[model samples]
Target: MDKNKNHVSIWCIVSLTSIPLIMTLGNSMLIPVLPILEDKVGITSFQSSMIITSYSVAAIFLIPVAGYLSDRFGRKVVILPSLILALIGGLIAGFASWKMDDPYTMIIIGRIIQGIGAAGAMPIVLPLVGDLYQDDDEKISSTLGIIETSNTFGKVLSPILGSVFAAILWFLPFFSISALSLISIALIFFFVKVPKDKDEPLKFKQFIRNTKEVFKDEGRWLYTVFLNGVLVMLILFSMLFFLSENLEKVHDIKGIKKGFVLAIPLLLLCISSYISGRKIKGDLSRIKKIIVVSLIAMSISIVFVGYTSKKLILLLIVTSIVGIAIGALLPALDTIITDNIRKELRGTVSSFYSSARFIGVAAGPPIMSLVMKNYLNISYITAGILGLILLLFVFKFIKVDEIGKSKEPA
Candidate 1:
């Protein structure tokens, strides 16, 4: 491969980067508004959480299918239509909120549609980035970091954006999401240029065989990476949900002020992710070391959160440490998976990994809601235990040199 062919274009960065930012905005923006929904829409705390879960549940099921389609067709071909669907979903929710007496059911339905759209957009991005620079590991690692940073940046911004919009009207966040989706669609349609696919599509039976073969050889570490990805997301979203509710009920904080409070840990997360992504640079040894140390730090931070509920500043400090840990772990996971997979199979395999992560996202809020109802301490302790389990798996199974080498076992 020509080194010159590996050059990443400015438009490519602009367009590919927009996908994760918009997706995060669509989802995380709803977190700060959950308390408001209870009052304005007459929903329970559990039901308010359904607003977040509904979107993710739809994505969890549809994302694998979208991955297959992107592999069979092309990345941009699938992404463009998915963004349009998300825009339509946002409009439906926004319109219902504007016009109806009770719009909770309609809003849930609209979010389901948005999830379906989200299934296709962000999940495909990792493989698309993989395709963009097939021969350049350093560039791929750095770009993946930037992508993760964009995602974390959106989390940092979403609360503030959601709170500001909701202050005007409870439904304004939905409308704001609709507008942002439109701009993302336009940017991707015009600027993102994915290379055309030339490989012959495999029949279902052959595709299954190939997938199994890849796993048979790579599954030792690959499976660990997938499970770790799920754990990382589950921990992050659950903690965020807990913090959001805690601030409102315990501290009497709400709206924009609450959003800024939420942003504290997320901003730290974004900065750590940017630095981690760049530093890993396709070195498997570095990826392993970072994952181990970060998991230990995360476990300790979360355990402290269980004990520090009375001190708001202490709670934030510990949560910020959790943020830094996850921020470091994510890009390492991305580099391991993307750097190891074959180009032809990258889309499908990476999508499955993403689908696993989405399962965590879907389950996080409701799980935390239940935990908080009974015992807040249980949630933090459980998170800490899970982190330890993930660390054990990383140490026992994941091998740096064995990854990304050799053909799939026959």
Candidate 2:
């Protein structure tokens, strides 16, 4: 890539990356405020969780559809409308919280809408980034890393921002989401220019046929990538949900103070993701090596986290270790899946991976809440075991050539 060309691509990449940052802020920002919502809305812990689950559920189902649509239509066409939908969703929730005596139902409805918009916005971003640098695996890996880092950075910001907004007024976070979505919409519209779709858009039937063919040839490694994506997300979100609740309920920490505490592990996650994203550089062996080692480390850390829950400092330390493990694993997963697929199928295949991930995000909080209620150790132990299982699968099945090409499935 020429200097001028690289500069333009970098500018576009920066603008495109904001979609995930804002989407994460919209969703994760509510973690610290969940307790406040329960008190204000007279809802149960599970009900408070639905506030997050509702959004992910919507995204979980719609993300693949959005990915297909982005392939069928165009990236910008899908992205712009999605942002508008998210903005509207935020307004609905914010208005209901401001005005209604019983706002829980309406707020959920808004979150569902927000999730629909989220389905289109962030999931499409992976393939759009892929579209930008068709021949440059290193650039794609690093750009995806930056995008993942932005996403993690939002997690780092969410607690503080959520707590601060909630302290001002319980409903302010919803309004903040709307304002941020609007800003992202403008940024994407004005700056992120994707290349025109050159391949004849496949007919739905033909697209399905091609999709099946791709899976038949690449299903083993592809499925591993999907499952790993889901596991990483589940562990990350569940731990955050658990930690946020623990800090507030057990330690008597709340508001901005609690947010800062939450930020510690997440800051480690963000930095680790950025560094790993740049380092993987599309090397298959390196990617596999990182995934295996990271999962092993994650398993150990999560087990220790469960045992150390009574000690805040120890828990924080263990949680940060888990953060590093997950942060390293995500970009490698992104690269492996993206690099292996043909560009035409990138949007659809990556969307399925993204949707699987949202499933983890959706299931994490409520499940973790239930486990924590009964046996806190169970939550961490289960996550650790799952990490170990993933490690075994990677060792057995995740084979790739020296130049990073996946072997055909038997």
Candidate 3:
């Protein structure tokens, strides 16, 4: 593993990094423009939220499947075709929104296709990173940090870029997915060189058994990671949905101004993720502490936002805190899970983790839409409570001795 690490190139990192960034852009870019979508397609807030949910829901079901495929065939084999699929899906969505009198249904179908592509692409990055540094916890953590930062950086860009694209045309953001995916596909194809699996591929039945056994021993920490994944994304997307809708309806903020407002917290998030990723340095205890503190911080921030006044500035400040909290914990989450599992099971387990995160992303905006229709504070409080529950679970059941052995294979 260390031998492979020496051969790593700048383009390989950039290419691997680009997958999460592009996958994130494909999904998160739509957040800011969703209200515009509602206007263009004559859809309700709920229906607009469905666009995001449909993409994520499709990914949720298929990520574990993709995980196993990458496990068997290889990451690039899975990633290249997935990017092509995403490009096609984006084109379908863009064209449908352009020509169809009622483009909502076709757009949703396009999103589902994109979701399938996403299921194959994003989750596999986790295990591939693990594959690159199987014996070095520090390198794995730091590199994963760069990757996570790229992911958050994409979020930072999404709102502003989405707004700009929407300014050109409501459907233009969808086409931008094709452009971004094309770039990533090219980067990966020409520059990225993933190490081939030398071990004989596990049969599907054996793969399933290994997965179940991973859970049998690592279930506590694994489940904690999965639950936290769901919560983190749900918190993020729900906030993005709220901010987009709230800025427009209540504050009379729209266009680039609104996009910048949405980007503020995410920019902070991107910076924090980079910092946290670098600082943790593969220490298991440190990862645990960050995870615990981040959860507490996020819970408090959400509760504060819920109980406090609705002033725009206050909301942004608290929301930025949430972003920072999320950023602080995510690398820890990635490292804790990826570094613990053996290489053979890494892709499948990571995919399950990605799927959990997708569930939150899929549910967040619609959940917010439903709550906003009645009461907003209820959703925030509920999220805060869930965060606290997770914190307790982590405090008690992480099984650090079993999972956190440094530089040693499980």
Candidate no. 2 TM-score: 0.96
Per-model root-mean-square deviation over C-alphas: 1.4, 2.2, 1.7
TM-score per prediction, in order, is 0.97, 0.96, 0.97
Clashing pairs for model 1 are none
Runs with alpha carbons beyond 4 Å of true place in candidate 3: 1-5, 307-309, 404-410
Which candidate gets the maximum lDDT versus the true structure?
A: 3
Model 1 lDDT tens row, 1-410: 57667777888787888889999999999999988988888998889889999999999989989998888788898999999889989998899888998999999999999999999999899999989888688999999999999999999999999999999998988888888889999998888878766777777787778888888888888888888888888888888888899898888888899999999999999999999999999888999999999999988788887677668999899999999998988899888888788877788888889888888898889988888867778778888898899889999889876887633323
* C-alpha lDDT of all candidate models, in order: 0.88, 0.88, 0.89
Worst 10 residues of 2 by lDDT: 401-410
The candidate, 1 or 2, that scores higher on TM-score is 1
RMSD of 2: 2.2
Stretches of candidate 2 off by over 4 Å are 1-7, 402-410
The residue-by-residue lDDT of candidate 2 on 1-410, one tens digit each, is 46444344556777887899999999999998999999998999889989999999999999999999998998889999999999999999999999999999999999999999999999899888788887578888889899999999999999999999999999999999999999999889888888867679989998898888888777877888889988888888888888988898788889899999999999999999999999998788899999999999998888877688778999899999999988888888888877777777788999999999999999889988888877878778888898899888888778775222322222
lDDT of 3 by residue, 117-142 (tens): 99999889888988876677788899
